[model samples]
Target: MKFLLIGQGLAGTLMGFRLERAGHQVEYVDAPEQTAASAVAAGIINPITGRRFVKSWRIDELIPAARLLYTELEDFLGVSLWHPQPLIRTLYNRGDLNDWQARSADPGYSEYMEDEPATGRLPELTQPVFAYAGVRHAARVDVATMVAAFREKLIAEGRLTSGVFAYDQVPALLGADAGARNGNPAYDHIICCEGWRARFNPWFADLPHGGNKGEVLIVKTQAPLLNLMFKHRVFLVPLSDDTYWVGATSENQFSHEEPTAKNRTFLADRLAEVLTGTTYEIIDHRAAVRPTVKDRRMFLGTHPDWPQLHLFNGLGTKGASLAPCGSQWLADYLLAGKPLPEEVDIRRFNQPLR
Candidate 1:
C-alpha cells in the first residue's frame, strides 16, 4: 500500500518507519518552515510523574517499545539518540517524602520508584532542597536530532515533499480512488500527523484538540551535572557536557506560537532557583504547541466518513514514549486488520468538543 503522511514530526516519522518496515511505501508532505512540537520538546520519558507520583499510563509497555525503537534508530542512522538516566525530583515536605516512601514500598512501583536516590553532582551544584527522590527507568530522547536525520534520509530518497500542504490539495491527491493524476502518483491512504496544526484540519477539527504551547531554553552551565534528570520548579535535563535542556511553561491560552520574552525570563528565573550558585549562559530558547487532547490519550484510527484518511496524533507531552508503541498499534491495525484500543479510538468522541 502507498501511504502519504502529512507532517514529518515524531508521530509521522514513527508511523512512516513502521509502515515501510511492514512492506508499505510511504512518502511525506511536510512544511519545514513551521516549527514542530517534537523539534522543541526535551523528550523526557519519566515513568513516574505528577505530585501524587502515580505511574504513567501503560508505562511498562511504553518504555520497552520506546527503548527498542530508539536503539534501532541509533543503529540505522549511525547517531546517538537515546540516553538512559535516572530521574531525581524534589520532595517539598515531610508529606511528600511519606508519599514517596509509600509508593516505593508497593510491589507494583518497585521497578519505577527508588528507595534511595543517587545524588550525583546535585549537592555541589545547587542549594539544599527539602529532600530528593529517585525514579528508575527514565531516559531522555534527542527528538530534534532524530527527526532531522530522518528528514535528510527521506529527502535523499526523494520520498519527501518540502512545502505547505493545504487541505484543498487533498481532493486532487485523493482523486478517483487516489489513482495516478497528471503523471503524479496517488496514495492509497493519507495519514494526518500534523501535531497541534491538526486542530485546524477541516476533516478532524471537531475532534477536540487541546493545543498547549510550551517554551524551553538551552543553557550551558558552568559546572557539569550529568547523571540524573532533576525536576525542581522546572525540569533540568542534561543534554551533553555542561549544557542542559531547561524549560517548559505550559499555556493553554496563548496569543501566538512564537517564543516570548516573558517565558524566557520565567524559565531563566526557574533555572536560577534550581541551579542556585551555578552560573549558566543561555544558548537558545524555543517554543511550540503540543497536540494535547481533553482526555489525554493519543488519537488514532480512520475518519468516520473516510477510511482512506487517518489520524495519528495527540501524543501530547509524552510523545517520545507514546509514539513508539502508539505507532506500532496504528501500523498493525492498518495492515493486519487489528482492532484499536477503545480508549484511543477517535470514535469515543461522539460530538466535537465545544
Candidate 2:
C-alpha cells in the first residue's frame, strides 16, 4: 500500500518508517517549525514519576520498545541518540521517602526502581534529610538530531516534502479509490499526525483534543556534566557541552506558542530551588503545544466515516516512550488485519463526522 503521512514530527516520522519497513511506500509532508513539540521536548524516559512514587502508565511495555527502537535507529542513522542514564529522585520529606521505600518493596518495581537510597549529594544541591533514590534503566533520546537525520534521509530519497499542508485540498487531492496523484505518484492512504494542530483539522477536530502548551529552557552551567537525570519539583537533564535541559510547565490555558515572561520566571524560581550554588547562563527558551487528549490516551486508527483517513497522535508528554510502540502498533493495524488496542482507538468516541 502507498501512504501519505502528514506532519513529520516524532509520531509521523516513526509511523512512516514502520510502514515503509513493512513493505509499504510512504511520502511525508510537514512544516517542522510549526509542529516542534518533539524537537523541543527533553525526551527523558523515566519510568517512575510523582511524589507519591507511582510508576508511569504501561512503562514496562514502553521502555523495552524504546530501548530496541532507539538502538536500532542509532545503527541505521549512524548517529548516537540514546543515553541510558539513571534518574536521581530526591525525596521532599519523610512521607516521600516512605512512599519510595514501600514502592521499592514491590517486586514489580524492581526493573525501574532501586531498592537502595542514593549515597552522595551534588555539591551544587542542598542536602535533603532523607537523601535520594535512584531509578535505573532510565534514558534520554536526542530528539532533534534523530528527527533531522531521518528527515534528511527521506528528503534525499525524494520521499519527503517540506511545506504547510492545506487541509482543504486533502480530499480533492486524495479522494479516489484508485488513489489521487500529487505530481507523479498516487497514495492509497492519508495519515494525519498533525500534533497539537489537529484541533484545527476538520476531520479530527471533534476528537476531544485537549492540547497543552509547554515551555522549556536550555541553560549552561560550569559544573561538570552529570551522567544521570535529576528531579525534584522539576527535571534537570544533562546534555552535551555542559548544558542542561530544564522544563516544563503544562499550561492547558495559554494564549500562544511563544514563550512568556511568566513561564520563564516560574522555571527560574523552580530551578533555583533544586539547583543551588550553581551559576548557569540561559542559552535558549522554547515553547510548543502538545497534542494532549481529555482522557490522557493516544488517538490512533482510521476515521469512523473516512476509512482511508487515519490519525496517530496524542502521545503528549510521553511521546519519547510512546511513539516507538504506538507507531509499530499503528503500522500493524494498517498493514495487517490487527485491531487497535481499545484504549487508543479513535472509534472509542462513538461519533462519526457529519
Candidate 3:
C-alpha cells in the first residue's frame, strides 16, 4: 500500500521507515522551517527514573525492540547513531541511597540498576553529594543526525516534499477511490505523525492531545566531562568532541515556543553547579513543544469516521525509547490487521472525536 506521512520528525521518519521496509510505498510532506522537538532532543534512554527509581513502563520489551531497530537502521543508513553509555545519577541523601538499594535488589530491577558505577570525572567536576548510582542498558541516540540523514535520503529518492502540509488536504483524499493528488498516485492512507501540532488536527480534535515546551542548551567544555550520561540537578549528556547536550527545562504552560532567557539561565546555573571545576561556553539554545497525552501514553489507530486517516503521536519526553516500538506497533496493526494494545489505541476515548 502507498502512504502519505505528514511531518518528517522522529515519529514520522520512523513510521515511514517501518512502512517502506515492509514493502509499502511511503511519501513525506514536512515544513522544513518548523521546529521539531526531535531535532533538539538529547535522546537519552534511561530505564529507571523518578525519586522512587521505578522502572519505565514496558522498558524490558521497549529496550530490546529499540536496540534491534536502531542497530538495523545503522546498517541501512551507514552511519553510527547509537551510543551505549551508562547513566549515573546523584543521590541527594541517605534516604535516596536506601531507595536506590531497595530498587536495585528487586529481581525485575537488578539488570537496570547498579549500586556502584565508575564515576570517572564526576567526583572532580561536581559538588559533593550523598552518593551516585548507575543505570545499565542506557544509551544516547543521535536523533538530530538520524532525522537529517533520513530527510536527505527522502529528498534524494523524491519521496519527500519540503513545505507546510495544510490540514485541509485530508478530506479530499480519505479513501481508496480518492483521486490522485498533485499528479502523484493516490495514497492508501494519510498518517498524522505531526507531534505537538496534532492537537490542531480537526479530525482528531477531541483526543485530548497536549503539548509541553522544552528548552535545551548545547555547551562546549574546555575539558571533557564524564563520557556517561549524568543527571545532577538536570541531565548532562555527552555529545561529540568536547561538547555536551545540557538541558532541558520543561514547561507545561507556555505562551510561545521560543527559547527564553529565564530557562537558559536556569540550565546554565545547573550546569555550573554540576561542572564545578570546568569552564564551558553555551553555544546554542533551542526549544520545541513535545506532543503529550493526559495518560502519558502514545496515540495510535484509525479515525472513527475516516478509516483512511490515522494518527501516530504522543511519544512525549521519552520519544527516543518509545518511538521505535510505538511505530512498529502502528505498522503491524496497519499492515496485518493486528489489534492495537488498548492502552494506546485511539478508541480508548469513549466519545468519537467530533
Model 2 C-alpha lDDT per residue in residues 265-353, reported as the tens digit of each score: 99988887767756888889889988898888899988766677899999888899999989988888888868888888888887442
Please give the lDDT score at residue 128 for candidate 3. Answer: 82
Q: lDDT value for candidate 2?
A: 0.83
Candidate 3 total steric clashes: 0
Clashing pairs in 1: none
Per-prediction TM-score to the true structure, in the order listed: 0.95, 0.93, 0.95
Could you tell which candidate, 2 or 3, scores higher by TM-score? 3
lDDT of 3 by residue, 221-328 (tens): 887777899999799999987999997898999999899999999999888888887888999999999999999999999888677789999999999999999999
- Of the pair 1 and 2, which is ahead by TM-score? 1
Between candidates 1 and 3, which one is better according to lDDT?
1
Ranking by lDDT: 1, 3, 2
Q: What is residue 215's positional error in candidate 1, in angstroms?
A: 0.6
Off by over 4 Å in 1: 177-185, 351-354
- Flag regions of model 3 displaced more than 4 Å: 175-185, 351-354
